[model samples]
Structure formats: structure tokens, C-alpha cells
Target: MKTFNVPIIYRSPLISAIKQQRKQQDKMKKDFTPTRLEFGPLTILLARHFGFCYGVENAIEIAFRTVEENEGKRIFLLSEMIHNPQVNSDLLSRGVRFLMDTSGKQLIPWESLQPEDIVIIPAFGTTLEIEARLESLGIAPLKYNTTCPFVERVWNKAEQIGGKDYTVIVHGKPKHEETRATFSHSRSHTPTIVVKDMEQTHRLAAYIREEAPAEGFYEEFKGQYSEGFDVTKHLGRVGVVNQTTMLASETQAIADYVRQAIQEHYQLPDDRIAERFADTRDTLCYATNDNQTAVTGMLNVEADLAIVVGGYNSSNTSHLVELCEEKLPTYFISSEEKLISPKELLHYDFHNHEELRSSGYLPQKENITLLLTSGASCPDAIVEAVIRKLAGFFGLEHLVDETAAAWA
Candidate 1:
């Protein structure tokens, strides 16, 4: 609940006023209902919890502070700071460069890095290999590290489960930076493997039950399991953890499935289940839970469509779009500028990783309703801009200003 000294450009008066009014109305934040902003025929239902989260604000504060404190030194980020393109672009405009892409592809040569050069570890953290590499270069990775504490908590959880002699089964995208970092950390502590979804979990369960051959395990889970991991030995006792940004429900489902699998495989009674399975809650981040829950709340209201704003590569943002798309038409856009016209718009399909043009995105009805929300990494200014653009279509700029003032 702490506020950070982020760049003023990322803030919006309208959004701030609305948030301030809500804070005054509900001090404990027990309300999950969407905030209704009415302007003539257009109604915007803003999620109660969205936009910059604690991890993001912390990263921004540390990143900008690093830039300000070190004026002349070359600055490099291990990867995209927080998955929002605008925020990353802003940092780039300020002379900060990225050493690697989100997929762990090295963009800059490791030989170029020097001990004096300021290197920032992103919110997603980095692999142990990368940390050791930085240390070998005489660069202290922790001094400018902005790795989120919530992520570190997942690693700690994995370590705790490992201490109990349980093989760590991570439910997450294997290629994601957070997952890779977690796998690196957890494998160092114990045998670890990454399962992307229920399908992968089912296959892993087959191996655990001895229905599949060990050779098949090596083939199916290549590069996803820790080195020296023996399927026959390590899969005996398992625990579940996940990338913090994953969908909370899916994580729970996977954990439940794996727990049931272990019980059935060993023919263990209820009391003996703990011997084969380490029962624990899903390690989802707070922002992920709040944002996903807010999306569920937003779905209860009737709306023409939903507009989800965030970086296309953002896992959390894509999940938000998925949640919205399940009930109604949803547009995944990074910026308000994507609202090209009243009749036409450009949006990105996160799954396809391509931009497409859509016609008749807006309804012809006089009374328009839209569910608007953004990912945790998105800036409030971007969400406000989208609202203003939509309001412009209905000539409701004055109404928006008056509403913001009244709320203030």
C-alpha cells in the first residue's frame, strides 16, 4: 500500500482523483466492485484493483533513482524492467540499455560489461548463471537489483519444500524469465522440473505412475528438468510452486491434480498423503490475485466490450485479456493510440503475437458501456488516455473533467 516516487508522466489526474475518492470511501479496500465513471451515454467500469503494483512501483523507483544517482556511467538492465513497453522505452530514452531480452536472448555481448558499469537486475530476477557471470565481471548484481521480493518468496518456498525432501514441480511457462530464475534457484536446492499446464502435468503423472517409460520422460521433458534429475527417483515425492504471474485458478488446479495423482499412484490413505505430496497453497503474487479477482468482478457487470491495456509480452496482461475474452469481446492494446477511430481499431493478439485491424469494435448504440482495466505493470496515465480517447468519440471531455474535479 506504499506509494513510490515514480515519474510524474506516468500519473494521471483523473485516475488519481478516482483512486483518492475510493480510498476515502473504502479505507480497508474491502470493496471489489468496479468504479463506475459515467459520462452521458458512455459508461466506463474501471476495475477496483489494477495498474502499477507494489513490485512495479518498487522497480520504477529503484530504476529511476539509479539513473539519477549515476549520471555518466553506462547503465544496463538484465532484461525488460517490468514488461510494459512504455516504461521500458522511457528508461531507454533516458540512456538505459537492456543486456538481454525477455526470452533470455543475449542482446549485448558479455565481454562489453565492466565492473564500473551500472547493471540493474529487473523485477523478474535472473538465473544463477547470470548472477555468477556478473560476479565474475566484478559487478555487484545486488546493488542495483530491483528483483521483486514476492519472486524471492517463491524461491524461498521452493527451498523450504526441497528441505523436506520433496522434488519441486514448477507450474509455469518454462521460457519465462521468472520461471527460469525459479528453476535455477530451486534446482540448486533440489531436483526440479517445469510443467506448463494440465496437459504437461498429466504426462508427468503418467511417468510417476510408471505408465510411461523413463526414456519418454527424457524426451518429453528435455531442457525442462534439472540436470541429473532421475524421473524414477525424483518424482516419488513432489511439491508444487509457480511463476508469480500465472493465473491463480490454473495454478491451483494443477496443484490439486498433481496431489491427487500422487495419492492414486502410491495408493496412499488420507493420512499418508503427506508422505508423497507436499500440500501447499499456490504461490501467486498479490497483484495477480487482486487483478484476476477484479476481472471476475468486472465480468458481473453488463458491458459492450472490454479493453485490456498492457505490454503484449506480459504474462499477467495476457491472462487478464484471457479472463475478459471468456465472457465478452476484449481488445488487448498497449497504448491508447491503438484506439485508431470510432469505427476501426488496432489491437494485439498476445497468443499470436501479431497486430490486427478490427472494424465495428464500438457499438452503434447510444448508451455505451465498457469494462476498462490494465495490467499491474501498466501506467495509470495509459489507462486514463484510453478513457479520454473513448470519451472523445462521444464528445464527453467536459463531463470527464467535471467528474474528476467533483471526485477530487
Candidate 2:
């Protein structure tokens, strides 16, 4: 809980009430619900945990400081500092350039970099090969490194598990920067493979059961498995870890599936199964856990429609949308601009992976309740903007002023 001086913008009375309720909840070790305020036509339900996470705050602080301290020097980011577009655009406007894109495509030629140029390693971290390349070009990766400590902890766990002579099964999107970094680091220690989801895990289990030909393994997991990975040999002893932001329940299910597959295949009892598969707990970050738990709490209350605010590419934000869509109508929008009107709204449907327009999203009920939450990289100021937009839709902008005045 290292505190940093990050500004939080919100309606003062609402923020104060939320803080008080959080304190009470902490004391009681139970969920706390603040009394709903009369803010015109909409009743906003703020989540207990949302917005910028520790990693995001640390990255922002370090990036802004780099800009302030090294005046006139060209500062290049290894990639987008975080997933949020506004944050990345702001850094770009400040003369920061990106060396690579999210897909690991080189935006700037590595040879162009000089010893004097400052290159900031992103929070997702860079592969060892990339690090070595930077070092060769006289760019010290450690000085401007913003890799999250939690992610590094996962890599360390992978190394420790690998040291025990077990193969590593990483439960995450293979193409994600964090996953790529972890896989590269883990492969150096032991054999590693990435499973995208339960579907892939089921296929892996079938492969472990020897129902599929061993030759298919190479073709099926061509780029995902480490070099010289033999399915028959590697699946014997394995340990499971995950990207820090994966859906918690899904990761647990994948681990359970792998453990059961190994047990049945080897005809080992519960005690003996531990020798083959390490029952590692989930590696999901704290912000993800808290925000997901809070979403569960929000689901206890009935709401007409849910507004999930954050970058569409953000894994945590998409999870929030997933949680909400299971029970209620959910709109995943990046900012207030998506709040086009009470009748129409534009949003990204993560399931379809496309932008869509929905009309008449607001319920006709006299008292409208909204479950509001944002991704870890989202700024609180954007959440405030969303609230103001909703207020304007209801012709209740005065309520925000009143709430601020009450706190003053």
C-alpha cells in the first residue's frame, strides 16, 4: 500500500460518502451500501473498487517524472505505457515515442536508438532478447523500467516451479505482452506452454490422455510451446501459473482440469497427484480481485442497465463487462463520448469484437439504477465525466453542484 499523489476527481459528497462506507465495510468485514442520494432521475451505484491500480499509478508517476526531469531529451516508450488510449495519447503529445506496438511490431527501428535516448520499459515488461538488444544499443533497461512487481512475482514463481524439474503451463492469452514476457522468461528455466482458455485446456487434457497422436502436438501448439517440448515427456510433471489479470474462476477451473487429467492418466491417488502437478494458487492482481468481488456485490442489487467504462482492449474492463452481462444489460464504453443520448449509445461488444450502436438503452423506470465501474488503467476523471454526462441527460446537472456544495 505505497501511497502516491494521484489526483481523484469526483462529486465531493458522493466521494466522501463512498469513503465512509468503505471504512465501515473494512471495520465490519462486510459489504457496506451507502444511502442512495437523489441525483435527479438516475441512481448511481458506485463500485467499492475500481479505477487506476497500483501498477498504473506507478507507471504514470514514473513516466511523468521522466518527462519533467529530462527536458528536451527524446524519451521513447517500449510500448504503450498502459492500455488506456488517453494516457498513451497524452504521453505522445508530450513528445514520447513508442518503440513497439501491442503486437510486438517494431514501430521504430532498434538501430536508430542512440546511447543518449531514454527508453522506458512498459509495465508489461520486454522479453529478454529485447532487453539484451537495448543493452547492446547502450540503452539501460533498468533505469526506466516500469514492469509491475506482481508480474515479476509470477515470473519468479515460474522459475521456482521450473527449478523443481516441472514443466510450466501458463493460463493466459499467448499474444499478450505479459504472457509473452512470462513465456520467454519461463522457457529459459524449463519447458513452457500457454493455454488460452478452458477450450484449449480440454484439448491439452485430451493430448495428455494420449487420445491424439503425438505428432499432432507439434502442429497444434506450434508457436505456443517452448522449443524441444515433447508432449509425452513434458506433460508428466507440470505446474500451472497465469497472467495476473485473467478471470479468476476460469483459471481455477483450468488448474483443476489439469490436475484431474494427470491423476486419472497415471492412476495416482490424491496424495500422489501432488508430486506431478503443483496446485499453485491464482496469480490475479489485487485490483482485479477486489473489483471482481465488488462487481459480485453489485450484482446482489437489481439494476436496469450497467455502464462499464474503460478501454475496450483492457482485460480487466472486459471482465467487468462479462460479469455484468451475465445478470443485466451491459454497455462497455471508454468515455462519456459514448453516452450519445438517452435513446442511443455507442459501445464495444467484446464478445463480437466490434463497435455497435444500441438504442433505447435506458430503462423507462422512474427510478433508474446504474452499476458503475472502470478498468484498472482508467482515470477517475473519466468516471466523473460519465457521471456528469448522465446528469446532463436527465437535466439534473445541478445535482452535481449540490453534492459538491454539501461536501464543502
Candidate 3:
């Protein structure tokens, strides 16, 4: 676990102390229990694993460092460095412009990019085509590349399975930059397709079993499948990989469903399963698994509601909100500003893609219990600010400083 020299604005002494103390106490990380921050009337059940992950930290360090190292040069990001709004805004404020949006929509034309201009490949990575396009401009895409190691690991896994003649079935959002990049890389080695969820996986299973017409697969899958992808030929052997930020369990479930389909389609024996289905569980991301499992463990305790902090459009953050919403009232917010007050809160309804204003969000009671966590891309400063805001509601904001000092 290599640490990065992330900007101080993104760090928090209080959260850092809490995390360090927890890490020291649980070296093995077997303890999934939340850290109970007792603040008289407010009991904050901070999740064991949350906030910025290794990949995000690495990206932040690289992006900011690139800015510092290249003062006079024009710098451009292929897309967002990470999903967090604060980090992206910070980069933008520093004059690091984006060439494309998250959906691969071009913001600045490729023709405008000069050979001397610096181009940064974001943490989500870019397609081989995009890489080629950058190279054509005489810009070294790899020099300022900040693609997360875990994402590259997934690509490597996809390539490995593809080399063995297995079609790569990517479990991720179809329009996601990472998935598109992965599809491009995998399709180059072998055929690849993107499945957003189990529903898509089930639809794909029909093709795998030859229960659906091959021509229909083209229309059904549409933009999801690779060019020159023959449903009949490619569906025979497959492997599952995912966008590192996607829900790990759903990816596994899709893989299991696809594997079962392949098993039954070929009527393969126990040991012969690998002949049709490639083992690709290794592609599941460590940070995604840890964050989700930590949420599961955190949910074991009874809390009034959960507050998830992160970018509204963040895939990883949305999944965390989804997990929390299943168990209790969960409010998805980008930062502490969404807290509004004790009685009223503004949160994002990710499913609907809109913000909702809610009253009586904090229960009317003497003592309040809350489960708090953030997405992998969220800054600790944001989480600490959230805690401080919640504490201010009870007039126990001083306790936060006291706790931090004690921990210090």
C-alpha cells in the first residue's frame, strides 16, 4: 500500500488520526466494525473503510504534480482525473482543461491539440484509439498517464483471457470511460462485450445458449458489442471482468450466471467448466470489495440513517448509496454543504438523477445515531467536514476538535 503526496486541502487531521488509530489497532484489517465517535447526543458510526482509495490518491498526486512541474505549458486531461467533483474542480482551477467529458463526448476538438501541449490520461484510462490519436498529435500519452494500477490489472486480465480465445464479457456501465477503454483493449486481443447488469447478462445468456436469433443480438446489444463481433462465434467461450469501481458482488453474480449458462449450453462436466468459461474473479477490484464489504459490516449495527458523501455521478459512490439504501434511509451527498441543517438536508437521488430536499431527515430524539461513509474518490476533508457539520447540529462541534486533539 504505497501512499501518495496528495494535496493538503484534501486531507484532514481528524479523519487521518482516526484512520491511523484504527489501522494501528487492526493491522490485519479483520475488524469491519465502525469507529464510534461519541459526541454527547450525536453518535457517529464511521465506516472502517471509506474515502480516497489507493488509485485515487495516486491520480491526484500525479495530476497536481504535473501541474506544478509544468507551469507555463498548456495541460489537458482526457477526461476527469477521478469522479470526485472537488478534485476535478481543483485541477480545472489550476488551468488543467479537459479534452472530453466522462461519456467520451469531445469537449475540445482533437484538431486543436498541439504537439507541445501536455495531455494527461485520467485514472479511468483511455481507449487505444484515443492513445493513438494523442500519439498522432506528437503528445506522449504515457508520460502524464495516471491510469490506476487496478484498472490496468483488469485490462491485463481481460487481455490474458482474450489470448486464450475466450470472449471478454465486461461487467460495467456501457457508457463508462473505463468500460469503453477496456472493451477497446480486449476486442483488439479477442471479441469483447459490455454488460451493465444481470438483466443484460441474462439477455446475453440467451445468445450464449443459442435460444435467441444471432441477428437480433446486433440490435439488442447495439453499441455494447465490439465491431465485427459474431454472436454465434464469440458466445461459446467467455470471461468476466469489470470496471474497477462497479459493484463487486453484481459482477460475480453475472459471472456465475454466464458460467452456468455456458455449463448448461455445452453440458460440460464438473472439471470441463473451464473449457467454456474462463476464471476471471481476479479482476474484481480490492478497493471496491473492501468498501462494499465494509458497508455490509457497518449495516449490522442499528442506525437511524446513513449519509454517503461523494460525487453524485460517481459510480462507486452510487453503489455505496445503493447498498446503504437497501438497509436504511441513506442520503447521498457530494459534500457537507448538502447537510443544510439538522432539520433539512439536500441529497442526490442517483436513480432519478436529481436532488431532493428532505425535511426531518434527522430523527426527533434525544440521542441520534448515524452511519457515515464516503466513496473511494471522496476526500477525507469532505468526510471530516460532514462530521463537523452534523456535530454542529447538536452544539457539540467543539467535541470534534477535542477528539482530534486527544487522538493527536
lDDT of 3 by residue, 78-154 (tens): 99989989999999999999999998899999999899999999998889999999999898879998999999999
lDDT of 3: 0.92
**Per-model C-alpha RMSD:** 1.1, 2.1, 0.9
Runs in model 1 lying further than 4 Å from the true structure: none
Off by over 4 Å in 3: none
| lDDT sort, best first | 1, 3, 2
lDDT of 3 at 364: 96
Q: lDDT per model, in order?
A: 0.93, 0.85, 0.92
Q: Which scores better on TM-score, 1 or 3? A: 3
Q: What's the residue-level lDDT of 83 in candidate 3?
A: 91
Q: Give the TM-score of candidate 2.
A: 0.95
lDDT of 3 at 123: 90
**Cα lDDT for residue 81, candidate 2:** 85
User: Which pairs of residues collide in candidate 3?
Assistant: none
The digit string of per-residue lDDT tens for model 2 on 1-408 reads 695655343223455555556656586436634224457679888787787788988888888889989999989999888888888988898899999998899999999999999999888877888889989999887899888888898899999999999999999889888899999999999999999999999999988888889899888887999999999899999989998888888888999999999999999998888789986778888888878888888878877888899988888899889998999999999999999998999999998889899998998878898888888888877877788889889999778767655644
- Residue pairs in clash, model 2: none
Best by TM-score: 3
